[model samples]
Target: MNNEVIVTCAVTGAGDTVGRHPAIPVTPQQIAAAAVEAAKAGATVVHCHVRDPASGKPSRDPELYYELVDRIRASGVDMILNLTAGMGGDLEIGPGEEPMRFGPGTDLVGGLTRLIHIEQLLPEICTLDCGTLNFGDGDQIYVSTPNQLRAGAKRIQELGVKAELEVFDTGHLWFAKQMVKEGLLGEMPLFQLCLGIPWGAPADTGTMKAMVDNMPPGAIWAGFGIGRMQMPMVAQAVLLGGNVRVGLEDNLWLDKGVYASNGSLVERAVDLVAKLGANTLTPEQGRKKLGLIKRR
Candidate 1:
């Protein structure tokens, strides 16, 4: 088991959890507060996603991102910030015989267009989802083609930001490694093995171990599962010699029938890491572990 753990709290995500949870970090202020709370609860990294403040829907507006980042910075918190570039890829295929019609959820855009905020803000780390997948039981699809990924990777490299490769399955991980081989994501690649998302890799020991086994040499990797598997995967990931991630982005409950805030989820993860006989890393230690220099 890994003795030192880096806990990353994904404060808010693009999922439709705004209405589901009592507190899902809708506005910039709320999201920033959530990040601060998670940091205070011992999260080394705060992975954030901005929302449409008025509608509480996921958004890719650079202005919203700017406001969110500004608030987090103004809070005087000392945690690594990781913004999501996984937005603008949702292609909600039309139901029935009109797959071409595209639903209102469709937000498809060019890969580089998705990184507009990343380019402008230049956080310490940003996510690059490695592949496409049929998101959920619905007809929605998270579209991240190889060409889009290549262009996105190139842009991220040029901006001199650390790319957290988000691999939803083995193929995504495969392509991620290929990007590293092609020198698209710099020398040392950081990976986030996302699991338990529908139609992707299931949350299980075998699958997590397999992904860990296939990670490129010297790859700094972390893994997490969605929903109820979130905490379990934290321990599983640590046991497998990888870091861990937890937060409202991947789950909304602290326990059965109990709602969770970002801070509470992070506290739970920290306690789990300790129980595993490993100590959670501080922001400075985590930055050093990931070779990240805080940039804005």
Candidate 2:
């Protein structure tokens, strides 16, 4: 078990969870506030994703991202910012034979186009989804081809931003290692093992262990499970010699029926880490461990 675990709080995600949870941050101000709260509650890193204030839907607006980042920085909090570069890849297909006729949810774009916000904000870390997957049981799909991932990984390296390779399945992890082998990623690579998402990797101890064992050597990695498996995965990740991630992004409930804020989630994670005889790393220590060069 790692003695120093980096706890990352994914503040707000780009899911349809605004109405589901009362405290799900919608506006830029709200998102930034959540980030600050999480930092204060002992999160070393904050993973952010902006939403359209008017409709409470996921947005790719760089202006909103700028505002969110500015607010977080101005708050005097020293949390590592990790923005999502996984947007603009949604492809909603039509009924049966009419797959060519895309649905309204489709927001597909090129690889670089998805990184516009990352390019503008220049956060300490940004995520690079390693591969595509059938998002859910619906007609929608998350499209991130191998070529797109290669391009995105290379660009993130060029930008001097740490790219957290998001591996949803074993195949994704394999390709992520391939990117490292091709020298597309930086010398010190970062990875996030995303588990329990619909139609993706199942949330189980064996699966998490398998993924953790297959990770590239010397890579800084974090693992998280969605919904009810969130806290369990926390212990699992730490036990497997990896970091931990928590917050409303992956799981909304603090308990059986209780909704959770990002801060509460981080607080719980901090306690869990301590109880396991491991301490959560501070922001500076996390930066050092992950080889992150904070921007501004």
Candidate 3:
């Protein structure tokens, strides 16, 4: 447990959060701006997801990804860019009456197509969701089979970009260990313990500890919880010898009736980490710690 913890802010996720939160960044400009703000407020890393400019729905558009990454780089914030390669896997089953026919909201794609943006941009780090699960409030299934994950990991390795392993459940963690054993991971693997997602690991001390205990040896890991559990998990993660992540992607409100800005969420996490007698890592320090070589 190092005293210095790297803080990552997942600024805006690619969920249906536009109408729900007035501050959910939509366009490339908005997303980049939010990322810059998060970096300035003490986030060493920024996890990103793009959305359609007009409809505000999640998009796999390479153009959008390019614009967003370009803007963040141009902003001069210098945060580690972590693009999401977790899209194009949404499956909303159709009526049982039409078994073979796919239903609405089924946007599944092959591995290469899903990670088209990562192939082009080659950010310092990109996400590789380790496993699939029943996702969200709907009956949607987020499919990430072993073969799909292997292909994605191979592509990420080909680009020489670090993969941020996102583990949503215990089974996901087990599969991640398998990847490590198979040598799919790099010298210093990076992981993110995503707690409190629907039908996944619950956001509690016991569950968090269990997940942390299961982390493969020598892996750099961070933990975050959703909604009201955001700040609490920040403290828990730090005390339990892991890094912390925060932002509107996992939480909408900063307090009882207060909607939070990305910067505010980051500031709160920084304060908590510092108060716990742990220092926070800068983007450069974080990159070094995570074994990510800066893209010239």
Candidate 4:
């Protein structure tokens, strides 16, 4: 088991969860507060995604991201910021035989466009959803082709940002390794094994282990599962010699009936890590462990 772990809290994801939860941190101030709460509760890193404050829908607006990052930085918290570059790839296909008719949910854009916020904000860490996947049981698909990934990786390298390669399936992991081999990702690129999403890798021991086994040698990696499997996968990831992630973005309920905030979820993860004979690292320690280059 890894003795020192990096616990990352994904504060607010770009999911359709505003109505499901009473408070989902739609505005930038709320999101920044959530990040500070998580940091105070023992989260080493914060993965952020901006939402349209009015509609609570996922947005790729650079202004929203700018305001969100500004709030986080101004809060005086020492949490490592990891902005998501996974937006702008949602393609909701039309119902029935009219596949050519894209639905209103479609928000497709070029790969470079997705990095506008990253280019502007220059956070210490950024995520790259390594491959395309069927987002859910619906017709929506998350598109990140090899060409897009290569270009994004190169740009991220040039900007000197740590790319957290998020792999949803074995194929995605395979391609991520290919990118590393091609040297698009700079030395010490991080990997995040995303599990329990629809039509992707399931949340299970064998699946997590299989993905961990396939990881490139000496590659720093972490994993998380969604819903009820979230905490369980925390233990599994640590036991399998990997790091852990947890937050409302991946799981809503802290317990069977209890609602969860980002802080509470991260506290639970820290407790779990301690009980497992391991400890979660602080932000500075996490940066050193992951070889991260922190920006203001």
Looking at model 4, report the run of 10 residues with the lowest lDDT sum. 287-296
Clashes of 2: 0
Tell me the deviation in Å of residue 256 in model 4.
1.1
Candidate 4 per-residue lDDT, tens place, 1-296, comes to 88999999999898888989887888988888999999999999999998888888889899999999998888888999999998999899889999879999999998899899999899999999999999999999999999999999999989888999999999999999999999999787689999999999999999999988888887999999999999999999999999999998999999888899999999999999999999899999999998887778
After superposition, the stretches of candidate 1 with alpha carbons farther than 4 Å from their true spots are: none
Question: Per-residue alpha-carbon lDDT of model 2 for 1-296, expressed as tens digits?
Answer: 87899999998898889889998999999999999999999999999999999999999999999999999989998999999999999999998999999999999999999999888889999999989999988998999999999899989999989999999999999999999999999787898999998889998899999998898888888899999899999999999999999999888999989899999999999999999999999999999998888777
lDDT of each: 0.94, 0.93, 0.90, 0.93
Off by over 4 Å in 2: none
True lDDT of residue 203, candidate 3: 91
Candidate 1 residue pairs in backbone clash = none
Clashes of 4: 0
Across residues 1-296, which tens digit of lDDT does each residue of candidate 1 receive?
A: 89989999998898889779888999999999999999999999999999999999999999999999999899898999999999999999988998999999999999999999998999999999999998899898999999999999999989989999999999999999999999999877999999999999999999999999999998989999999999999999999999999999999999999999999999999999999899999999998888888765
How many clashes does each candidate structure show, in the order listed? 0, 0, 0, 0
lDDT by residue (tens digit), candidate 3, 162-195: 9999999999999988988888877788889999
As a whole number from 0 to 100, the lDDT of residue 53 in candidate 4 is: 85
Higher-scoring candidate on TM-score, 2 or 3: 2
Q: What does candidate 4 score on TM?
A: 0.99
TM-score of 3: 0.97
Question: Higher-lDDT candidate among 1 and 3?
Answer: 1
